[model samples]
Target: MSDHLTVVDHPLVQHKLTLMRRCETSTSEFRQLLREISLLLAYEVTRDLPLTSRQIETPMCAMDAPVLEGKKLALVSILRAGNGLLDGILELIPSARVGFVGLYRDEETLEPVQYYNKLPSQIGDRACIVVDPMLATGNSSAAAIDLVKQAGGRDIRFLCLLAAPEGVARMREAHPDVPIVTASLDDRLNEKGYIVPGLGDAGDRMFGTK
Candidate 1:
């Protein structure tokens, strides 16, 4: 509905996200909530996917029904935190191709560096969805999308569990053509780069680490 990022306000998504935000939530519970919320978010993300008419046999007579049109989906998880969202999305779209982009922050430059990359062949022809839990600074996320585009991924979408306004603004400026889907858009980023009123580090929480 809005430009740039689409916030999914579904009651279930909000309810589960609340559990995820609580300080007492266990690692197991947090992981479960991430999967559930990501699945719910996936439904909204794929809402406008193109469809084509297909001939099908009903209980009695033959009928023409609508089926998804175009190439299979290419899911690129911005590794570590992004993997949390990937598992649930795959459950919903089992046949979707998978890709991974490993990036780490350059402490000095505050930039993103690619450490790993593995994507399906002909990424340009497929519809690509990049997943990440939090969009804090937007440097890594933007860099990941840039790599995807360079690999020929023209139709791209970004999915996240939480987003900060600063990060959203950065993404809009960097990649306006790629729409963003997230559960909530938070107030702002703190001095340390953690989102204010944010759900904390997604990778550490999901994996039960510091």
Candidate 2:
């Protein structure tokens, strides 16, 4: 709901997203397109990264140039499909510190529980971006954000390929300060909690599963 939550509607992003939505898209093509879209989204996500002036000698002459300033960003992948997004973001910002958080849904309780957690040292001082391909129920994503917060990550943002309205509302209610970026917002979750008309299970599609 906040202005910070930007839905990137760039032409390139839209084109790739359309291809990704096709049921016929091969796993290889889907993965490739996700990576490409991630890179394009990264450009928009990092547009506000602080820049500092530095003197550098170019082929022409020494001139003041703008370079990334202060602490490098920490890109955290929320496991599985999140890793796909991480690959492309890393391609854009190769020097960014990387982290991972893995969570699984407890069948009976339907709550997310962490299985793996690894974050950069001194996360409080770094801007953190969490990547997950889909924001469906928002349970896992919210839990991942909680894990990042416990690790001292204060400045955080989330990125996803698709999100359900319920998921976005849940996220906003739970963590209003953390803005989310996604390509599209679907209607709502079905009885099974899958985003209606969603591209299906991102993990399944990305990994070539049922």
For model 1, state the Cα shift of residue 195 in Å. 0.9
Per-residue alpha-carbon lDDT of candidate 1 for residues 53-98, written as tens digits (9 for 90 to 100): 9999999999999988888999999988999999999999999999
Clash number by candidate, in order: 1, 0
lDDT of each: 0.92, 0.90
Output the number of the TM-score-best candidate: 1
In candidate 1, position 22 carries an lDDT of 96
Predicted candidate 2 versus true structure: per-residue lDDT over 23-97, tens digit per residue: 999999999999999999898777777889999999999999998888989999998789999999999999999
lDDT of 1 at 57: 96
Q: Candidate 1 — what's its lDDT?
A: 0.92
